[model samples]
Target: MFVLNTFDIGECLSFLCFISVSLIFCFFMLFASSVLGGKSLSRYKHTPFESGIDPVGDTSLHFSIKFYLVAMFFVIFDVESLYLYVWSVSIIETAWKGFIEAFIFILFLLLSLFYLIRIKALNWVHK
Candidate 1:
């Protein structure tokens, strides 16, 4: 025999209610849009509008490699900082093992940074 406890039944009912409400809301919005929306055939309406300023020049402009390199460095350092923050927060619980691991991680990051600097990867003027 299949049996469900009060908690299980309540959870199931809650889930079903949530799903039904979401569906109803979605359908209502779709129906309302269809009823109230206006059709437009203006030529300017289809063009991309940028704060009323007419777009000029080539859309596909070439960017310097320095820009991409700096962006990549920023992302890498940002993620490293996030890892360091998490490790710092749980330092007391993790103790020496965490400290050693964090040290190694930071060491590798420092080495990579030094290597990039030595190779002039961050030099914008040289390019």
Candidate 2:
């Protein structure tokens, strides 16, 4: 088997294609395994439990939209911090370009902050 150096454009594309194919194949295999296993589909699985007590009625209750919004805000905050760590490492090497890229990244993230402010999402004052 003759190996091609990554400097060649063909080799680089092949490398990317290999990664894409491997990821897609792995995902499909995992999905197929879960679907074919089919181990937990019994009627008892649909029941809810409270302290090992019998299930209660009206389990399909609606929740406040604010609850979901708060969860999203928390996820955004955590993911944005991950980006900051990568930016810190890159800025030491690339200087101005890295700084500009990091600034742009924060600018986009600030849009979420702006939205939170507009909705008074963080306000604890009773309406």
What digit string (tens of lDDT, one per residue) describes model 1 on residues 16-56?
99999999999999999999999788889877788999988
Error of 2 at 112 (Å): 3.5
What 10-residue stretch in candidate 1 is worst by lDDT?
1-10
The global Cα lDDT (0 to 1) of model 2 is 0.84
Find the 10 residues in a row with the least total lDDT in model 2.
1-10
Q: How high is each candidate's TM-score?
A: 0.68, 0.54
Stretches of candidate 2 exceeding 4 Å from the true structure: 1-52, 121-126
- Residue 96 displacement in candidate 2 (angstroms): 1.8
Tens-digit per-residue lDDT, 1-127, candidate 2: 4676546889779999999999999999999998897686788797776889997677788987878877888997998899899888777687998888888989988987998799898775658
Q: Score residue 34 of candidate 2 by CA lDDT.
A: 88
Candidate lDDT (C-alpha), each: 0.92, 0.84
Count backbone clashes in candidate 2: 0
Inter-residue clash pairs, candidate 1:
none
